[model samples]
Target: MKRCKRVAVVLPVAAGLCLVYAPVAVADADASIVSAEVSGTLTPGARASVKVVVMNHKAPAGQKSCISAKMDGGGGTSCFDLGAPGTSVTHDGFMEVLKDAKPGPRTVTVNLLPRAVGGLGKDTKTVTATVGNAPPACDPVSLNRDAFQLGHTEGLKDGREDGFADSYRQSYDDAFKKKPGLTAEQCQDFALSAFQNGYGKGYETGFKEGQAKGGKVGEKEGKEDRQKGNTSRNVTIRQLRVTALPATGEADCAQGVKFTASFLGSGTGTIQFHWERSSGKVPGTIEFSGGDAEPKTVTDQAAVPAGATTATLTQKFVIDSGPSKGKTAQATANVTCKK
Candidate 1:
């Protein structure tokens, strides 16, 4: 940590980062950190804090220690991660970063890391200011948001007809700045908590972890015989539709898609909201304005839009009078189909 051009900041459970950035020294380290609370956006007042952790590599087994400091990146030496070694002392609410002033790349003072925990008396070469921050990557947001909090709730399976999985990974990870030196087991659970809040009732995103794929023993013979004799029919009970047009300028971690749906034709007799899965299909839902309505009302409905693959959507309504009386109505929720 002392007299170094490139300091490696090793994060436990994961390798450290290379603090091969810039460094700036200041006459008063503590005063500068207290004065440099970078902030932005408070349509929502921004809350900020500084963590100063000091470490003594050569200190004796049972003696107290001293600390020094520095900053870098912006013209001011007000940026850093830790100041105290055995403990992380933090300071908050000193200054505010302008909402309009774009945040430039931020770097920590590596040399300052050791100096913060002041060197031994008369030991000028013990530890000096270096450049870089801990955990390597600076996640300002994780500091602000809970690891369990759902940030950009787009495509939550609980809220959608089909559970959206793959899309939520990054945002979930972003919410939790996992603790330093976290274990592998801890990491797995850490990842789970990030998306836990997203799996609210009515929407279960994860799979049933322990149940077997095969049927249970001591099954009823009547049901087994009926199942062997009966035919399996596909039913498209509900559909999904979205209204937003292909949006331009999606956020850094989003891919916005938009579309609309309709149940233009009617089932001359009975009608019902539906759900179904085909040989190869994604689960979807029927549009509901909170109450049961006719198919025309189903027209121009808002849903998650047609996905990349195609599926046949059969509207299961009865038409009693026609030669196909009592037969279900069939339609395709296809992109090329007429609205």
Candidate 2:
């Protein structure tokens, strides 16, 4: 007897949806099979039935046709001859679970191969059914008070172990059913090792979640601390000055203007001074001494061109380091020429 080939089958979980896999038809006008389904207790040696609706684009109703169906890993192919455009045709493709079938989910595949000139291409569908073993019978038991309390604790432990084992077993079974590549022993080992390390699995999950939350909290706290420190240091700009001096020949002959910036703060840091002029001269930057209590000053000079009537100098002072970083002040001076 020829044994059926085992293949992966992905079934739809939605109600009234069939797991159909149909290739492009070779026929001029394609025919199709839809709503193919399997129904039966998947227990070992149980009877089962498969049904589908056959449709043909060119064939009229009442036309006789042949179709075939087969399981994924069990009995051989079964064929049926039925009328065209049939509804719920239970063709000769009835199914039966083997006596040695294991207790787990099994894939049942049905292929609709019709024999017609320029027939519709092969249409295949699959479904999953759970094959179960006979459940063990419960035995009567009587326990004293201490035994009852101990039993309660043991029951909780047993429950968790059983759940863990079952979860791994189900996962392995699903993998096998989808691709029967793993031996039974391999599948069992996978489940057993996973169940044995349940605590490690739980710790890994918890650790990642805790680390992410801690990282966010730590980042927020660090920003707040920096702000508090900067506020406490209290950095300030004390004064700014601009002076213009002309040559001896003319009071307003014009030469250059001097810019100064002074800083005052309790925080020890570097102060950056930026100088600008209304005469469209190139701007310049300079550094000044900065620290607690004592004032620090920096200066820059901008040349005045011949046609320039007035000189406007602007200075911006910024604390560039320590807790007082980002604090800034500005000053401007205007010098008029005598005509």
Candidate 3:
């Protein structure tokens, strides 16, 4: 059994309206499987673990329903009631069958029963487990909480052992006292330090290892696939925001024009400012300055190339791309998502 190491699963969307529909699909799709994955190699008599998670798949939104294991190799089968609702579920290896000699290709069918009813939906996914193989040396990783990023290990615990309980206050103090804005990397660093200092130091190892893996931050670089050619994964945005400062243009060619996306989203993502020609003469060399850590303006505004009607601008988040396909994204572009 070739165990697929993929963690997240991309589910089916409706006929159209990709943006507003993902959460809906995850919540309402009765027979569809969002993500069902497995980790670990089973040796004859060795214990392996399986994990699963769903997005708003059941009542209370965050809780996962139930899961069971069925052995396809010579090994026997068992099920874990989970005993309660959770957004994620995990179970250790088959204790009874670990001593058996069931080797070679096998399958561990992970059935996610959301509510003891139609919760598992009509279509559920199954991942394979290699009965005999050289197991990975590193400890398993995780991608818990609200989001799942790519080109990065899914579940790398920071140094903090007690979750957010002991470290948030210290982290907030450091971030506020030292800088005006915090990047993801910096936040992770702060989190790592807090987790490490409060906890032992083991939790710090996973993250460094995960980051040592050089990868960009984004959806296209990891386990989940991006809905290509579709707006679900790719997009072009135009943000028109009302600023606190007056809209009066300055006479100085250098400081006259203005741009702001770089100033928003807490610097977590890039913001491109294009002078909507429809509004006014797209000012030449529009300069940008923001209340971010790197508080310097792009004074040497790049010249707009010939044949360009609206200025071409780009801003990117310092995130890793995919181990899967494109990922689901939410943005504030001044346009409607197509179905």
Candidate 4:
């Protein structure tokens, strides 16, 4: 033991031991829906395809993720798996517009779930799809034809009334001159003119109505009707009378005198006439349309002869054509001359 102790115990001092600790790196697990789109026309009772894209910000190793979509009204939920970190995945599906669906924009919502034990909360995205109007169902050709026939019938009625007024006016004029009224040929021309005018107006109105009821076909038929301008029949007229306003007395020399002629009639057509004054004749014309039973008037002025203290003037209204043709109505006025 003494010898061993003296041998200078060479048991090497155990080398000082050092321990180091390091932090473990954990991966981030976050996923989100990037976008969603719906393609194809979305008419009622029609189907359209849907597309959704999802992106993951970071993914834990071996983690699973999924994206899903649901439409606002009725399409069921659809899902697809997501890719790795910093990558995007696309999901495709289809949706249908209900037969009774209202026209306008509809929405689809998409959601993303990381599926990892501890990942970011669910991410959501929305897309819009438009629903269009349904196609028309009526027979367009039949609608257009009905419109034309309606217009023609109404036009004939209007044309007859107008034609009658025209012929009646001519008959009155001829009768006033003790001559025969409108010839067959002349009467036919008048009827044709009236028919064309009435038909054109009625056709336009009916065509527009038809277009509202029949769509494109109605428009095409309307154009054809306008180009036709077909002709038809004619008719007659009734009474006429003229009266003078202020038929008794008046005054003012420098300012002259004013006279008015009023005519009342129950028919249509143009009338030719003249004013016969103590001075001269003034020619004129007046027209009537429809079954106007109202009075129409015209005016004229006369000057007092110079140097005359008291002046008496006479004015006459004469019809040159129509049932009252050649008939005359007269009036007198007394004026005080101013120097």
Candidate 5:
């Protein structure tokens, strides 16, 4: 392009980008696009070279013909001097798809631009190129690991306590046969490869069995200890006190006998108080809860039967937590009733 300058920049595919540039004066004209052809392949994670061929309705010698090709949205342009009316030019450029490009057909466009003084035309044509999947890299260690995982899964699926060992061994042996020389420094199998793979398999099997057995034994021991109340920390119920105001009362016993229950202890727990009228056939009993600590008190009115002469209230406070959980302290108070 003598009159109009164009710079074609072919960016390296390694950078995941490709560029083609052709800068020309913009104008609308009437010219026939003889032919516009684009050919390329879409490759995942690699650059693809595209060949663009364009033939136009000819222009003067000083006119310019620019061919541009775009692949998956990346485009580049190249310009050539129009020799005759049947002028044609081929543009070579590259385009890149994403490393994780999906396997499908990608759109590629080829544009033809004729720079003519009298009047020219802009033409574009689009075609599809299939992007192929990337080739798999060779990795022996990964294969081995995959085999090991499969074996473990098989063992679990078999529902046998010791099945994992045999299953893992079999899978590992099969993998070893396929990739005998495969080794990874970080892999546990690397050192085991020196010996028969079976030995390593057996060791793993036994280790798993031992672990299961040890877990069962530990669980059983823990259960037995719990049943025996063999706790590392034990809380003891040290004292219990009960008091009744107006220990001797008459028919006024119905007036409300105040019974106070106090418990003293050194632990964190709830103290349950069970109060009952044991002496007289009092109909109702009071049950309340208090904190397990020094000077924790609970008070409730003692129910006195209509004809009862005395109300003997018996009470007990039980610890509901701590090492001394379930231990109890007992106290009693007497309320005499007289008409």
Candidate 6:
């Protein structure tokens, strides 16, 4: 009868069973240029000291962050490693100004490349440096050739993207309306048509843009070169036009109305102008440094009264002083406040 009393013993199970954990990976975040500065006389064939401050925005701890600075036109690039999130690093480097570099302001671009995670970001800042004397007489042949090439490259890129988008949208819409689901052959055909259309449009756009750009460059350079030594030339307003947004439709009262004034001028002097509005007037001026008749635009906004349900806005661009004084162009917009 005593054998009925039995005891059970329990052993530790944690030691017998092993638990394993995989390490978690952290993704890198974009870094940004907080501030950038370039100093020293940037003369031809000289080096200018550059200082850049970079900050990591949201990268987790232990993530690798880097930023590189490259001059816009041409120069060696400098890169630096950054610290954790909310941390900033300062990098000091030198940028060389090419002997043939153009005078005036130049741009320096900063690129952020996260190492741990694949991501890219960039920012640009400008530093004005006098690389050389006022641009020497631009050679017509050389200017035209360079401008043509630049225009063609830019136009081709833009046109190809636009054409592809248009073709793809049309093809997708057409295929979607078919009786059955889109087939693989239809998809192939869509892609082929898109690419062919893109190529054709790109070539046509590139040629036209190249010719137009070349003409404009040639005309501007020719005029500037011709009037370089003539400081006594008086500015003359050659053309003036004004346009208003929502010219005859309803618009938000708070959002206001916009007016644009475009004018073309010739000669080297200052042109005094003013915007005459239904409510008030604003005085403005434009300085023409070269003799070329370049087109310039000025924009103005008209605000509606807080309680006004409907209003008529009128704006006039007037030439106050110059040979073309008294010349005026005006536009009117009728707006109704949105409910």
TM-score of each model, in listed order: 0.19, 0.28, 0.25, 0.30, 0.28, 0.32
* Candidate 3 lDDT, 104-153, residue by residue in tens: 65555555455445444323345665666422222113312212332122
- Report the C-alpha displacement of residue 153, candidate 5, in angstroms: 47
Per-residue lDDT tens digits of candidate 4, residues 126-209? 666666675444343443354445446675443443443344434333333342234434444444444454456654455445
TM-score, cand. 5: 0.28
RMSD in Å for model 4: 41.3
Q: Pick the candidate with the highest TM-score.
A: 6
Best by lDDT: 6
* Candidate 2 C-alpha RMSD relative to the actual structure: 33.2
Pick by TM-score: 1 or 6, better one: 6
| Candidate 5 error regions (>4 Å) | 1-40, 71-73, 114-121, 138-339
Any residue pairs clashing in model 2, and if so which? none
Error of 4 at 318 (Å): 0.4
Q: Candidate 2: list runs displaced more than 4 Å.
A: 1-28, 60-67, 76-78, 81-92, 115-121, 134-339
Please give the lDDT score for candidate 1: 0.27
| CA shift of 51, model 6, Å | 64
lDDT of 5 at 335: 56
- lDDT of the candidates, in the order given: 0.27, 0.44, 0.32, 0.51, 0.46, 0.55
**Runs of candidate 1 exceeding 4 Å displacement:** 1-18, 21-58, 65-69, 72-107, 110-198, 202-339
